[model samples]
Target chain A: MFELILTLVLLVIGFVFGQIAEKRHFRSIIQREAETRDLLCFNERRIPQDMFSPHVTLVCGSVVVSVDFFKHFVATLRNLVGGRVSAYESLLERARREAVLRMKAQALAQGATSVWNVRVETSSIHQGQRQGIGAVEVMAYGTALVPR
Target chain B: MIVTNIEYIPGKKITQHLGMVSGNTVRAKHVGRDLMAGLKNIVGGELKGYTELLTESREEAVRRMVAQAEAIGANAVLNVRFSTSSVAAGAAELFAYGTAVVAE
Candidate 1:
């Protein structure tokens, strides 16, 4: 009985704090994305022919995020039904956006006007023995074109 | 060395193609970080330790790739790409590859 009560209390705490953190992260991502709008980023395998850049370098950004216990619990329940797990979707979205933002920031810092062949890779880390997911990592990388 | 994910570098000419070069590294999180990440999961936030680990692993892979390119006397690496996979329960491998070239 005590264990059950403790689990419920943790779930409530996770729900409340997790929601707040997710909201804050989303706001920050939106704001930064707007700020870096002018930096051209693409997945094309070729640099624009018209581009007059003489120097190119690699740039990357990475982020690791984990779902709260409440969402993890909910996702496990959803898994029983064997359908889409929406609870983890938002977690992935946040991590991807954040990683891209950081990569853009790096390019901008290096005086790069554009990034090409951008790619994002994701992986799951720190899975508990019994729990489903402990954390997810998103890595964004690209070549930055800086004009001479 | 000049490194770009694109097949061709604008305004530069490739004098020779040195073939493919690659670097890879596998890393695992420490127990302390694993514990910390577990707690962070309860609250739902960024896991700084894992982020740092991935970053370090990427840098190491890139460095090794560049070393290989230099060994072939290549001045640039083109069409660079990276990949990651879980090799173990608590470890991941980061791999980077590109075509080394001599350019001017």
Candidate 2:
């Protein structure tokens, strides 16, 4: 009975705090993305003949996001049903957008006008004793072209 | 040395291709970070410690890759790629690879 109560308490705490954090993070991401729209980004390797810049450097951004206890529980139930685990989807979406935003921030710091050949990689990292909780790491990288 | 993920650097010609070069590293954070991460798991937020770890490991991997390219007399590495995998319970491995090339 004690274990069950503790679990329920943890779930309630997770649900409340996770929702608040997610909402705040999404608001920030959307605002920053709009501000960063001028920084051109492309996954294509080719650059137009007139678009070449003299200085090139590699830039990267990475983020690690963990799932809340309540979402983790929901995902566990989802696994048993063999269907889409929506709880985790929002987690990954937030992570990817944050990673990209960080990458853009880095590029802007370097005085780069554009990023080319952008790539994103995501991995599931183990969190030691708490294997029940899911943590994902997302990394965004590209070459930033700085005009002379 | 010039490094870019694209297959070729714009406005430059590749004089030679020195095959493939790669570097890899496995890293684990201290117990304190793990404890903090566990606590952060409840509220569901960014793990800044893990992000720093990944950045450091990636820089190390890229440094080793650049060293390999230099040893092979390549002035640049093109088509660079990065990958990560959890090699252990608390350790992650970062790998970087690219084609070593001489460009003019």
Candidate 3:
């Protein structure tokens, strides 16, 4: 009975540590900061905002995916374990959603109401040093429009 | 290797397909300092890397696509388009496409 309890405790601790480690790694991978040159407007005492054209080229964002990643890692595991792959699904979906959000922000900053002719793409990337190979990337982009 | 943007330009042939390209790679870094800037963007801060990569890759891929166009007896490419895929972590594929055309 003691041995069984100890084993269970160890498993819980290990799982917790794994969650902590994975969270850090995932956050690092999902970099959601903006760039200066991509800027349209901001409040600052120094530089006059009018100097730079408020017209910003909006972008929804991009992603690199490996179907095998979902298949082998998440999907396969879910199939074998009979559980949901919510964590993995959220990563992929968030990337797409966040990208579009950024574009919307850019448009808003530039006084644009809507974007036009948006383009979204998914492409395969088979770059592994050896043996196992599979991955995919999705990129979303669109033009920002400003009224004259 | 084909571009949708080039379509707006007249006298260019639009290729519906992207040309075959290999080793067309793009690398971006979120250096510690860069991350600070990005975090700043959270509350009226500046985000980094996204635009630069977009502009850089677009130009590079377009250049490559243009070379392919020249090889195929085309004068200008129209309706240029851009795409990116991660072939590996730390390495991304940048593809540009446009219609290859000789002046009609």
Candidate 4:
């Protein structure tokens, strides 16, 4: 009975707090994305031929996002069903967007109007007996074009 | 040395292609950081500790890559790429690679 109560309590805490944090983070991401829309990003390997003036540099952004207890639990159950894990989908989406936003911020700070050849790398971090994802690291990098 | 992911640096010509160079490092966060991350996982948020670990590892990898480039008489490294993998239970491997070239 005690174990059940404790698990229930943890679930409640995880659900309530996790939802609040996700909402808040999403709001912040949306606002920052709008603010940084002026900086363009492209994955094309070739630099624009018409682009003149030649100041360029490299920029990168990285972030680590952890899953809440409730989401992890849900994902584990999802594994049994062999289908899409919605819990992890949102988590990855958030991490990827956050990483790109950070990269754009760096480029803008360097007086760059756009970034070219953007690349993203993701890796899962495990801790303590590989008990479900401890966290995920997402890194975005690119070459920023600056006009002098 | 100039490092960029693009094949060529803007306003510069590649006088020589020195070939590919790479650097890799495996790193793990301290116990304290792992503890904090565990706590944060309950509530779901950004893990600053892990982020710092990745940043540090990436810098080290890049530094090694640069040293290798310099040894090859290259002034720039272009088309640089980064990769990350979990090589052990607690350690993450950060790898960087690019072509070294002489630019003028």
TM-score of chain B, per candidate?
Answer: 0.96, 0.98, 0.56, 0.96
Name the runs in model 4 displaced over 4 angstroms: none
Error of 4 at A18 (Å): 1.1
Q: What is the lDDT of residue A38 in candidate 1?
A: 95
Per-residue accuracy of model 1 over A3-108 as CA lDDT, tens digit each: 9998999899899999999999999999999999999999886776688688888999999898899998999899888888888999999999999999999999
lDDT of 3 by residue, A20-133 (tens): 544553564455333323434221212233332223243445543222222334454587878777744654554454455555565667666445556656554444544323
Model 2 reaches what TM-score against the true structure? Answer: 0.95
Candidate 2 or 1, higher TM-score = 2
lDDT of 1 at B13: 91
DockQ of each: 0.71, 0.71, 0.11, 0.71
Candidate 1 chain B — worst ten consecutive residues by lDDT sum? B83-92
Q: What tens digits encode model 4's per-residue C-alpha lDDT throughout A1-148? A: 9999887888888899989999999999999999999999999888877884467788899999999989988998999989999998999999999999999999999999989999998878774455544688999999999988
The interface root-mean-square deviation of each model, in the order shown, is 1.7, 1.5, 13.5, 1.6
Model 4 Cα shift for residue B1 (angstroms): 1.7
The top-ranked prediction according to lDDT is: 2
